[model samples]
Target: MARYILDHSTRPDPLLAELAAETAAATGESAEMQISADQGTFLTMVTQLVAPRVAVEVGTFTGYSSVCIARGLSGGTLHCFDVSEEWTSIARRYWHKAGLADRVTLTLGPAQDTLSAFDQPIDLAFLDADKPGYPAYYELLVGKLRPGGLLMVDNTLWTGHVADPDRHDASTVRMREFNDLVAEDPRVTVVILPLADGLTMIRKNPDLS
Candidate 1:
């Protein structure tokens, strides 16, 4: 249903081609991880709009989205969570080259643990981690987000698997559940935009009770 709508409306941005090339070249190696350029642009646009002072990002895959978010943040702090040192090392070089290393902090560990340790209210949060953990991450992050804070979840469409009842993989199942959960929740307003695999945007309201 949603996939059909998005499929017809979807159009690729030109910026992604350049970023994809740069990200691939920077790694100098092929891997199973990489984000679409359209997604990267979405992150950057969101960051630029909110101009958050403190941001939390779960799943910094090769730092493409991280770099995009960080670039939009002038003097703000961006906390990135990832368990892979090898993957992040590749990200670091690009961060440094992009002159955004100083504003970004990489936490090497399970994202849940890293997120739990934070005591301050997050101005903005990005969740792109394991599909099964979306519920848990949402619980914790929503509690931590300040009023009007933004929460962005990537890969919500699961490559059009969520709507297909026949394709019930664990990841797809979890994503479907998460999507339904968010839609029903009254604490925030959500917009599931069909851009580069689908991004679910949630804006928290302080008065929701």
Candidate 2:
């Protein structure tokens, strides 16, 4: 651990702001990408219980979500894939300050290539990458995740765009398609939660493993 691991509660912890400050300073960007308190809590709870040894995060942004996942798992490594060195560098600094830098591996490049290169089985994964990439990410992750592994995706609701047939933005359209695909994906058990944005959590059935 390189820095303090902020305690995660049902509500947002005050320390989250302090961590965000470090991330913001490093990236020179606003904290718009940070996960909301509710979503953070959900991620923390899942990680703590699942205790995944190998976790993967797509679309790390400034690393807010990665930090949350790291704090939840008592002792496991999170491999974060993102294309922004500027932002991930900021995330790395905060992770170092939080004493969690050692537990997190930041990989810079296209997420698909990085994920495809992963040879080890993944125990848990968080997807918050490009919207159109969701279905592909899911297809890749489902095979990589071991039995009982958890896959939690952020922004599945796309700010309620899926319900509106009128919004035909590329991202929204892709999300709608992915939503339908996941619903029919019999290989895993899925649940959609209306947390900040929206999170679609899937637990891969044991048979798939």
Model 1: pairs clashing at backbone N, Cα or C within 3 Å: none
The C-alpha local distance difference test score for the whole of candidate 1 amounts to: 0.82
TM for every model, in the order presented, reads: 0.85, 0.87
* Model 2 misplacement above 4 A: 1-9, 21-31
Write one digit per residue (lDDT tens) for candidate 2, span 165-201. 8999887888899999999998899999877778999
Candidate 1's clash total is 0
Candidate lDDT values, in order:
0.82, 0.83
Best by TM-score: 2
Q: Score residue 171 of candidate 2 by CA lDDT.
A: 78
Per-residue accuracy of model 1 over 26-95 as CA lDDT, tens digit each? 5666533466655666678789989999999998877778888997796799999988897788678778
Candidate 2 vs. truth: CA RMSD? 5.3
Q: How many residue pairs clash in each candidate?
A: 0, 7
Q: How many backbone clashes does candidate 2 have?
A: 7
Model 2 per-residue lDDT at 38: 62
